[model samples]
Target: MMIYLTLFLEFFKIGLFAIGGGLAAIPFIQELSKNYGWITQEQILDMIAVSESTPGPIGVNAATFAGNTTAGIFGGIIATIGVIAPSIIIILIIAHYFAKFSETSIVKSAFSGIRPAVTGLIATVGFEVARTTLLNMEKYNKATNNLLSILDIKAIILFCAIIYLLNKYKKHPILYLVAAAFVGVIFKY
Candidate 1:
């Protein structure tokens, strides 16, 4: 069907340009959510959470989840492949050329230029996620004047607590994730 084709192509393009990681793919996913009405901002946040908690990579998991929601099992398969195809192809190409030009200045310069751009993309996704997660966009939309009222105090407190714990212990991340989950359930967030 046309929907499946569109999903594949759209996610393929996302995979092609999402140079950093799953976080970097968030902007593309958000755009698709807007462009196709395939998902909501709230669903995007949920997808991020579910994807992070699951076994696989977040971007692939997101593509699969969205595709399944849109169509069905086949859509999930196609979208997952679409999002990873470019990475597979690019890795092959890079592997082929890397041995021959491992010391070339041009290649080094290309990677040097790419690293910061990837970092910027990842940072953009972080801001976007934070904006959605820590702010009450529904309240903001109803009345834009009261910025203070639009902040989600509980999420902010939990975020700060997690940061503090991470800084203090620097332990495994799963501990923090479990703690957050427990807090969310307890607070009914």
Candidate 2:
């Protein structure tokens, strides 16, 4: 009822605004902490980890995860519908307009202008994802709020090793993800 509607609207907004993809949506979902009180940053990270490890689009996975977090399976369904609605609507609208304006110079110029805007959006999303994953120290610092040095060293070495292994081997991405998780656990970092 109300819950589903809210879920739909919120996720619809998320889908509409989070242009770059699921990873880009992370920051906005983080902002949900300010109002929803439903999920936390650590949970968001865990959701991302699980989503990346699973099938389908990352954005879809995230919506499912967030929905499940809010109200179990029902919530998940509502959220997923919300996430997809905007794309569906936009595609339909664009299809109609594109057919009508396919040959217009004004339409061509508008598209040319939109291309750069989309590029900028995508680039910004990439930067934000990098900032979250790469810029932060590996773990929380107890006293100074800085990253724990040992944890960081482990992450750096692991990152390099994973990169090298990826370049050397053409294994499935899932294998790399599994290997990274295993290495993280065995190394206890």
The candidate scoring highest on TM-score is 1
Tens-digit lDDT string for candidate 1 (42-69)? 9889888999978888889999988887
Candidate 1 — which residues are off by over 4 angstroms? 1-59, 62-86, 141-144
Candidate 1: 10-residue stretch with minimal lDDT = 138-147
Assess every candidate by TM-score: 0.59, 0.56
Clashing pairs in 2: none
Model 2 misplaced regions, further than 4 Å: 104-189
- Model 2 Cα RMSD, Å? 6.4
* Tens-digit lDDT string for candidate 2 (1-189): 787788888889889999966787777678775678778888998988999978789999998998899889999999999999999999999999899997899989998999999999999987776556555455566687655543446566777787898899878999998888888789896
